[model samples]
Target: MKRGVRESIAVSAVLLAALFILPLLVIVPFRSELLTREPPMDETEGEPFVSGDLDSRTVLKVKNGDTVEEMDLGTYLVGVVRAEMPASFAEEALRAQAVAARTYTIYKLQTGGNHGSEADICTDSTCCQAYISEERARANWRKNANDYEKKVENAVTATDGETILYGGVPILAVFHSSSAGLTRAAGQVWLNDLPYLQAVDSPEEGDTIPNYYSRAEFTAAEFKEKMLAAFPEADFSGPVDRWLKNAVTDSAGSVETVEVGGVTVKGTQVRAALALRSACFEWEVQGEKLVFYVTGYGHGVGLSQYGANQMAADGADYKEILTHYYTGVTVEPYSFALPG
Candidate 1:
């Protein structure tokens, strides 16, 4: 080959490589997939995915409404961290959230996921982790937009490629906003009794959390209507005080079971029916209404965001916070990597 020809080919190759690399450099980590609601598929994997292995190049398929979003692991996690944790939280707490979000996504991928082969997870908070677009986060932060965005990005990057594992496998790393003084055991909130998700003390209380304690009042007639819709056999014939009876709760103050009317109902069932903030609640009948005194928010399971922040403030690192919330789990980096 002539020298000029070889030189010309090398220059073109370099330019082509630069073209691809430059875009990635300038592009922001934020991305949002706009899709209609996805049609239901056979969710064989009830919750998470299988095979706890991944590399830097791994891509996650996230179900957003009706469309599937494909993005690199790092990029997807940045959006997840921003949506899942408040950037105003301590840096360590944000990092803990970042690791939890990362572990959750990987668990979904390893467990084969539910959205068929098309997706490994979903954007719906009720289903999987919550994720948001850059614009939405910016709008929510307003004046603190730039700072908050950087905080989340740093949190994610700081813990890049890390995960919480149990028995060398990626656990279902579930988390919530707060707990009622204690996190619920896996068997208490889920079918399986995962050792790592044992009930543990949470540090945050009413003083730390704005809505640590809440109330939901329903008139006697309204209460009966809603209760009957869920528990048709519920007996609401007696006095308002007798409507809730035989309340059973755990040491952590999590209401386990209660008798509503004549039907025995789980606390979770009651929470869903009444739209209460947490399962840890007690009710009082005053006048013609029943007021439920609720404590904490979310499902009262797994890691508590507020608790984590408190721990961070107390001088605990991200790993320590995670280890405390998710018992017997190690915060470790993934072993698998792509060959250079």
Candidate 2:
């Protein structure tokens, strides 16, 4: 071969070798560290640090009495899971709850939470995620405390450092006690149209679950009084049936709008005015009282706890359950940097 041709061939061989060997050189050093690292500790009975690429030591400002105390993120989740869902639920459902709780906490931390304190979140279910101290939860569990604690801890450990994300950011992982056979889109229930919170069928929700159906009865005088209080301009002179006419509902059967005493009001407004369980309700007059038969519970805007349990019962894992409820979401290991 000519000298030029021979030089060109030598250069090509070197480039080919570099392309194949450089990646190995980069990865080989970390391989032993990756392989020999201890398996994540058993979280059932001890304070096992979360294993991930992100910081595991999250500090939570917890409101206890008038003073606030900082808590570990994992410990806080145990209490949150206990308050949010029943321990008797399937392990997968509990694991899903753990991830949702973590995602919610991080979201709140990212956005300024409504707690109005130096807290990342609150224990109040209405204000934020519900939580009970380990002592109180164990007390409430009574004879089943040990078993229940083990289950919740196992769930938290199994999904440690995991969160549901949309577009690489933690999402608003809102959840409810139950859904009306389907989850509602965020736009349908709220003013925002979050792409990840679209409506999805949750077929597992049905009459079999407790409080799948509920009734609230009020005397004509009482109903009239409540309506008048909410809508001062409401004309309550006619029969009760006419008062709640023209109920326009969304695709999920939740009352979106209705004519109450000649005033147009949203079903959510009616639910709040009457302390109803959900917007998915029907009202009727029986003799002298107004009766409301309500289906489902909670705001019906996110993962249904009962529905998740049913899915777990049907063999769906935590990842499947989370993805099913949160449309187009990825369950990925995440960690947030803690403040010094």
Candidate 3:
């Protein structure tokens, strides 16, 4: 059977959305196809294709509609999938559609403007990459986007009610997507009352942290000396040498909670502050400066899409891809389909 694709226009900026994946609690069974083989594409259906030339819509300037709308790049991406992708990607698309359907369903039932319009979708920094040349996105489009549309369309059509209850309240529906560009390693999904439902570069991609692009290099000694320089009167131990030997440790107890300028903070945060203070004395070679350069983007707790793509490219099936990061979760039919 063929499935349909669904999409929503995003109004928010993409960079603003650091983390879009919502955490799990809903018992929706992940279809094996969601993490397995994608459904077959229907060559017969006449779907629109993006040629190497310019897309007409891209040139359309933003104008004020009857009601202003705002959305994240994630929502726009989902819309692109629905408008351009195929059923193969649609029926089994992961992450994006799940969030989008939930968001759309929520919004359909809610009134007022608790959520912004689709004008706010941003596509800057790590939040989103420039649209790939048609040549590059084609392969990707074939493998992933097409099928995702089907899945979203199905979910949207299948909703028994117009709105979904998230965190106990009904809100508008809008999905989000991204490389998770830059942020601390905690996955939160409040844009629509969801958490890391679609995290890419999750922890299962092995021990290597997905560096935004290197490593944290500030020496503990250098960090401490800078801290001492910042707070000369505070009773800090001996020179940088002594502090390096016993200051910071992975152990929770090693963290000393202290009040600084009327604000109490954890040892790690304090250590981080010292590192930043020291960094000010260093050089800004490429982009961000850090004592320790962490790799990848987003929290390392769920699935890593980049890793999954690499795996997929290397011939790893979707199930293998899903299992590699999602820990232990079953992928079965939810018996739900989008209503016509």
lDDT of 2 by residue, 113-188 (tens): 8766566677888788888876787779877777888898878878888989999999999998888888888876
Q: Which candidate leads in TM-score?
A: 2
Ranking by lDDT: 2, 1, 3
Which of the two, 1 or 2, has more TM-score?
2
lDDT of model 2, residue 27: 87
RMSD, model 2, all Cα superposed?
A: 21.5
Q: After superposition, how far is residue 29 of candidate 2 from its true place, in Å?
A: 66
Query: Which is superior by TM-score, 1 or 3?
Result: 1
CA deviation > 4 Å runs, candidate 1: 1-55, 335-340
Across 93-133, the per-residue lDDT of candidate 3 in tens digits comes to 33323333333332332332222444322222122212222
* Candidate 2 residue runs with Cα over 4 Å from true position: 1-55, 338-340
Please give each candidate's TM-score: 0.80, 0.82, 0.33
For lDDT, candidate 2 versus 3, the one ahead is: 2
lDDT of 1 at 260: 89
TM-score between candidate 2 and the true structure:
0.82
